[model samples]
Target: MKFLFDIFPVILFFLTFKLYDIFIATAVAIVAAIAQIGWLWLRKQQIEKMMWINLAIIVVLGGATLLAQDETFIKWKPTVLYWLIASVLLVSSLVFRKNLIKLMLEKQIVLPVAVWDKLNLSWTVFFLLMGAVNLYVAFSFSVDIWVTFKLFGATGMMLVFIILQVMVLGKHLKPMPERIQTVNEQDNLIEKIDNKAGKK
Candidate 1:
């Protein structure tokens, strides 16, 4: 499934880091990311812009870490990606008058514009906070601990955030009488979330 495909790299990186060193884990992650994209391309699917950005971070930051024989660059990777996404979401919402969360979920779950704005702002704030947390853990903890934070802590928080989002959205779900949309739209939302997961 798309979810599995999206998480394959992070899982691989975690396992690789456990069995080997950070450099080895970085190499494995980069290869896994590339393979994921290639597999999607072979299916004639369009890769999300964010997936390419993730790959870039892995290769560039991971490459720097490997080249300098230092883990600092790699440690900053998640924070960099997180802040970048948060910035984009905030800018798009405020400057361009675009609510990305609503853009992604509008067809699947109808809600008032004000509610969508709140959801978008919520995600923007979440990403900003997540970025700060990544940096705090990276600098305040050991390499091993940071790796665990990257894989488990970040993922756990994300899952919790998603659950809360669902709970909030429950009250805003459109009435059943308006369920004229196809299942494909719902599936697309899943795909969107899966692609978003590529940030890790």
Candidate 2:
């Protein structure tokens, strides 16, 4: 499942850490993530830019952790990644005349550009806050606690943000254009009928 694929790396990272150590766990997680991404690509999934960015960040940070012989470098990985994505979101929302999220998402979902920009800006701030929280926990709390927070806290925050977004977008999510969902529904029905006939 899509949800499991996205989360497998995080789960593996924690498990590997418990089995090995921070540096080795990061190395193993990076390998596992690459395989996961490759599987998605082979399955013809839409590989978003954010996905690639995440992979690159992991590789770089993981490598840094190995080369430096410092777990702290790896510990800061989430903080860095969160803020970097947040910065991109903020810049796109502010300077781009068009909403970057809209450009990426419009082909899949229809909504006004203003609403798209609002969503982008909200994500930007949310990511920034997530990054700040990561930094605080990583430095202020024990490393073990920070790792637990990394595994659970970020995920919890993201899910809450998504649910909140759905509520916000509900008002703004344009009624599905007949050309989109309706047409797809018809195509699926026809395919099912053809398959049933073939089986008969």
Candidate 3:
């Protein structure tokens, strides 16, 4: 699945850390990220901007972590990526007068402008909060705990957030015309019954 491909680097990083150490895991992550991007290129697939950003961060931060033999740089990678995404959402919404979330999802969903704006803002805030949370866990915990947080905490939070977003979107979804007409007719009949009861 595409989801598995996107997260292949992180998965490798976690497994490597479990087997060896942070430096080796960081090195593995760097290689995996580059390989992922190269594979996409060879397939002639259009890489998403987020994927490019991820590769850049992995190479730069992960490389620094390996070269300096410091786990700090690699630890910051997720926070950096999260903040970058937050910035993109904020800038696109405020500066460009566009909702990046809506732009990404418009083909798959249809909702009112207000609903789109709400979705965009919600995601922006979520990313920002996640960035801060990553830092807190990375610093406040042991390397092993931090690594677990990196893989499970971050992924779990995003999955939960997405499920919640889907629930919200369901509430704002535009009903089909037939469903709308049926609802309207039911409302009219109910109103008629209420009037007849009141008169009697």
Candidate 4:
């Protein structure tokens, strides 16, 4: 559900492009992004920083597409956004010695420090490659094909990457301390009960 929500604008853009044209699609995408932020604001939800960044990028690039009557601006939007994310991930890890991925997921899953670094670096590289791939598709193909790739190809790649990451993480995740403590408590209680029953 959250994934669908996150990609709502892209889905709308693809459908609009099929029904209309690139210009109309770009407009719809811009409106959809604004509507997302508006809806969240109305609901008093804490809009994430990424959401705001996405909204800003769409408004600027999509607006340029509309104002200048050129689809190039909109086509570049994905690459720009992807590269920005990759830069953030790389800079945070290398310069500041902070692993943003670990900061986000450490509370939920525990892993060795080396694993955290590797995970962060992996995501950074993935986003960088994805940005380059978007550029390759956007310029190498027709607008229709680019739109299709934006909706399906890009999304499919991201899903596949996440599945691969999950497979890797599965091997390294450790049992939470709380879970271990609960299991130990249960075992001790069962052992005491068994000893009392044996004496009786």
Candidate 5:
């Protein structure tokens, strides 16, 4: 439910962005994020700290875009968002018993504490790397290429990362899904046939 609630604003942002400029899109996302916070409060859910961070970045970046009427401000927002999140992740690792990312995902994954720490470190490093890549693309590359890279290249890299992680953790992961595993009755059937022949 929380996950579904989270995507609602992203969907809204896509729609608004399609119909308007970068400034309007940024503003819409900010407004939607605020609404999401309100919804969380009303439902008695703990507001995510990352959501607050995201909100602050959106508000500041969106304000700048509006004030300057420059799409560059909005364009650079992704770089800012990535780096800021990465910094927070690293800081959390240093200050807390568990990194915040690990805490957020702990309920879904029943990994050992050491595994959690490893996961936290991996995510921290990945975010930092991604942040640097985003900064490079946004500031140094052509605007069209930067936008395209952000939309497509980043997603592709993330998918690859997930595949790599799964492969690396195959031994530690749960066995094949029950539905996909065939029952091993052949050996039993053969044993029963041989016993009947011997009795005869």
Candidate 6:
């Protein structure tokens, strides 16, 4: 559900492009991006940093496409966004000495420090490659093909990458220890049992 929501604008853009043209699709994408943020704000949802980044990029590049009457701006949108994300991940880990991925997932899962670093680097590299791929498709293929690739090919690749990441991470995931009662907790439990028996 969340994944669909994240790609809402892309889906709308692809459909609009098929029904109309690139210009119309760009306008729809811009509107969709704005609407997405507005809806989240109205619902009092915590808007993620990445959502804001995406919205900003779409508005800027999409607006350029509309105002200048050129599809080039819109075509560059995905590449720019992907590179920005990759840069953030790389800079945060290397210069800031902080792993954003680890920070986000550490509460839910535990892994060795080395594993965390590798995971972060892997994502950084993947985004870089995705950005390059977007450029290749956008310039080498027709607009129709690029739009289709944007909607399906890019999404499919992302899913495949994530599945592979999960498979690799599974080997390193630490098994959760079984819960054990402390001595004090055991004493409390026994006292409660005795009290219940006395009442009976």
Q: Tens digits of per-residue lDDT for model 6 on 39-100?
A: 99999999998989999999999999999999999999999999998999999998999999
- Predict model 5's lDDT versus the native: 0.72
> Residue-wise lDDT of candidate 1 within 1-200, one digit each (tens)?
77668889988998999999889998899899999899989999999999999999999998999899999999899989989999999999989998888888876788988899899889989999999999999999888999998988998999899999999889887844345455667888999999999975
Off by over 4 Å in 3: 175-200
Candidate 4 per-residue lDDT, tens place, 72-148, comes to: 99999999999999999999998999999999998899999999999999999999999999999999999999999
Q: Per-residue alpha-carbon lDDT of model 2 for 1-200, expressed as tens digits?
A: 77777878888898888777777788988898798779878999888676788788889988888898878887778888889988877776667665667777787778876788788888888889998899899889987788778888888889889999988888777665767788899999999999999999
lDDT of 6: 0.93
Q: Predict model 1's lDDT versus the native.
A: 0.90
lDDT of each: 0.90, 0.82, 0.90, 0.95, 0.72, 0.93
Better of 5 and 6 by lDDT: 6
Please rank every candidate by TM-score, starting with the best. Answer: 4, 6, 1, 3, 2, 5
Flag clash pairs in model 6: none
Candidate 4 backbone collisions, by pair: none
Best by TM-score: 4
For model 6, the superposed segments whose C-alpha errors exceed 4 Å read 176-200
**Which parts of model 4 are misplaced by more than 4 Å?**
186-200
Worst 10 residues of 1 by lDDT: 175-184
Q: Per-residue lDDT for 74-126 in model 5, tens only?
A: 66676677777777777878876547756676555556567767777787778
Each candidate's TM vs. the true structure? 0.87, 0.81, 0.86, 0.93, 0.67, 0.89
What TM-score would you give candidate 2 relative to the actual structure?
0.81
Which model is ahead, 1 or 2, in terms of TM-score? 1
- Better model by lDDT, 1 or 2? 1
